[model samples]
Target chain A: MKVRRSERLVDMTQYLLEHPHTLIPLPFFAKRYNSAKSSISEDLGIIKRTFSLRNRGILETIPGAAGGVRFIPEISETQARVIVNELCERLSEKNRLLPGGYVYLSDLLGEPELLRKVGQIIAAKYKDQKIDAVMTVATKGVPIAQAVSYQLNVPFVIVRRDSKITEGSTVSVNYVSGSSQRIEKMELSKRSLKKGSRVLVVDDFMKGGGTVNGMKGLIEEFEAELVGITVFAESNFSGCRVIDEYHSLLCVEEVDVQTKTISVIPGTYFNK
Target chain B: MKVRRSERLVDMTQYLLEHPHTLIPLPFFAKRYNSAKSSISEDLGIIKRTFSLRNRGILETIPGAAGGVRFIPEISETQARVIVNELCERLSEKNRLLPGGYVYLSDLLGEPELLRKVGQIIAAKYKDQKIDAVMTVATKGVPIAQAVSYQLNVPFVIVRRDSKITEGSTVSVNYVSGSSQRIEKMELSKRSLKKGSRVLVVDDFMKGGGTVNGMKGLIEEFEAELVGITVFAESNFSGCRVIDEYHSLLCVEEVDVQTKTISVIPGTYFNK
Candidate 1:
């Protein structure tokens, strides 16, 4: 059915937001709205300007035949800072400090709004890079990876602690567990990644970066290229990490369980 | 910042799509767009009409001092049928059959677009219900749960196969694994839910419905109410299932490993 300019603007914005980082030919929208290419172009212009003014994202237009508009989701540095600072505050809560020096993160990671914010910040860092997939270890990192995948319009694969029969063939890698300093095994399905794929690795927390190193190993095993590594938070308490370069949204400066006091600061991501 | 009506419609539509199931008072949009209440109302009317005409969702308006509008996402029956049919064809692939009568579903679940559609379908079913949270067992169910949670604009709590130290205190339940017929333990963080909270249980697959029942046990332990149960797929080869009432998008009738044949049909969700 044909739609007027107002209806087109509303529906077009909704569709673009849902499908970030993907190219949609103008004719596709033109046909769907039963409008001419010229009118569709005008509607996209409004959406693009509004998106930019609001810091919602970038609307990239490709010219000529087989070209269209793409929504590249982004977050302004100011908004990103606010979100990270708020997360630091939440992380510093005394009761969140659990035994074994690990703070409770289930609640924070479960919130869709928070996850999306964190995802936007982290995704913005690699928005310009060509990332074929988002990789994360199973359980906690699943939510974060899923959020980023949605923003990047990419599929995410989970690397599990233990292999499930349903995953078919698997690739296993062993690395020292940062906290325990003991060798641990992590596995990803052989079918999850194609060789030479560019992968971005993300996780909920980082200590000595052992888990990130472990995932790096799996990426190597699969013959895939590691585009980058980032974590939601990393502990500053660790003196040395296996992987030196990475991005973190929050840095845990201290977690004094005995004193029941925790300190968190914005991550090195800002410093970079 | 002040904006014109065209820009406001574009931005307003983006905001409403991002924050589904949340009530945003007219004054909020009015203030955000720096427009008069009357103008905002007119803009919302246009958005509401476009939303309905596109079958995108329902833009519900409430009139009162504390009233606002809520976006309840919806997927039309026609689109839902098309998506489910495509899923059936994909699941019936000969290579998808694995040993132990299991099918490889990780690839399908990892997809953001397909998962969003599935999420919309499941979320549409319970959009009107009072659901405090959506619950699923890790690790495959995480993506599906997150997608649905996005649609419903609610938090999702994951039930883990094994409790992690980071989860703090957890409540564990032992259920007989449908495929293995052995008792398996699943756990949920004690803080993930509040007592008497209304919960919806979702999973990626079901055979004898052991996992769903296990989640129900956790919900019972937490003193929460079970609003509903649903799955992405269910195997029907088994003559009996512990669960009789549930919704499934796809049903697997047979997975003949020897002959390398697989059969999938649309699930009971459509019939109901």
Candidate 2:
């Protein structure tokens, strides 16, 4: 059956959004819509124009027999700053303060809309880099890694503190805990990360960068390259972080355990 | 700026996909596109018809003064079966089988595209239910929960085996480990879940049903209702499952340790 242009546009939009960072040849869409190449090309032009006009994302068209269109989702700097500013307010809630200067982030991270936007911000920043996989420690960092991986259209690896039976053969690394100043172990499935792949590390929270450092070491053990590391929030309470090169979406400038006050600002990524 | 019908359809499709299970007032779209209601409705008509025809999902338009449109992401029965069947093949790979009847699943779960489809399958099963949140026990379950929550447009709560300080005040519960017959503890932040919430539980794997049973009990302690429980795969090696009523997308029929053969079949959901 012949497909209408409107129908073709909607279906094509959905497909591009679903398969981000993936190239789909013109013939593929033409056959799916049972339309001519010229018609499909026309539909793509409209989509490309609209996507750019709305700042939705980038739609790159590669010309020639082996060429196709690819979608690279992006969060504009203006939009990212807005999201980070809003997070600062949410982090300032008095009830989020914990006993030992820890700020509760589970509630904020649990919000789906917030997580989606946060994922967009992080993925947008690294969209141009050659990232093979997103990596994070088990438990808190899993969700963030999954979110970023979704946008990048890449697989994610979870480095666990405790090795489970289901992981099969594994690679383990021991590092100094940045917070406790004690030795800790982290491991990943041998089958999870490819040798010499580029990996981006992400986490929900960072303090003294112990966990991030641990992941950096584990990456080396896998023979993988550490492309970058970013966190949702980082605390300066420890004053001495083992890893100096990192990006954070939100920064905890101070947490006054004495008065139950927490001051948070935009993280190391943005200009203050 | 005046938005054309074509642009409106593309933007609307992207917005609805990102915000599934959400109601968007027609006027909201009209204002966003700076178009008339009649034009907006016509654009929606194109999207709705295309979505249903392509099996993308259901586009529900509620008419009246307080009415709007809602997008419910779904996977058709045939599509779900295909995914489950493909999973059977992946699970049956000889290398996935490990000592002690365990099957390595991290590689499969790490795939973003596969995880998105799995999330859609699980979300479609519980799309109509009043799911306040998607809950899963940490480490393996976090990605699954996040994926399902993304489709359902609901927040997800992580129940950790060991509580982290960032969780703040938490509610802890002890249950007998289904596989080892040993008692283990689980904890969720007190603020992570609201009382009287209708929650859906999901996980990466199930054996002996101990973890699911523990979560079931934990749900009751929170005064929340267990709307449903689903697992990516369930192993029958134990020959005894603590939870009787649960759904599995793939089942490990048998694993021959001596011969190094693994037999997997479509999970309990299919009639095979």
Per-residue lDDT tens digits for candidate 1, residues A1-272, read: 66899988998898998899999999999999999999999999989988898898999999999899999999999999999989989999999989977888898888888888888898999999999999999888989899999888899999989889999999999999876789999999888899999999999999988889999999999999999988999998556678888999999998897999889999988985
What are the per-model numbers of colliding residue pairs?
0, 0
* Model 2: per-residue Cα lDDT over B1-272, one tens digit each: 88888888899999999999998999999899888998988988999999999888999999998888999998889999998889999899998888887888988888899999999999998888999999999888888888899999999999989878778888888898887899999988998888999999999999888888888988988999999999999887455768988889998999999888889998887644
Predicted structure 1, TM vs. truth: 0.98
User: What is the C-alpha local distance difference test score of each model?
Assistant: 0.91, 0.89
Task: For candidate 2, write residues A36-71 as lDDT tens digits.
Answer: 999999999999998998787999999999999999
The 10 consecutive residues of candidate 1 chain B with the worst lDDT sum are B236-245
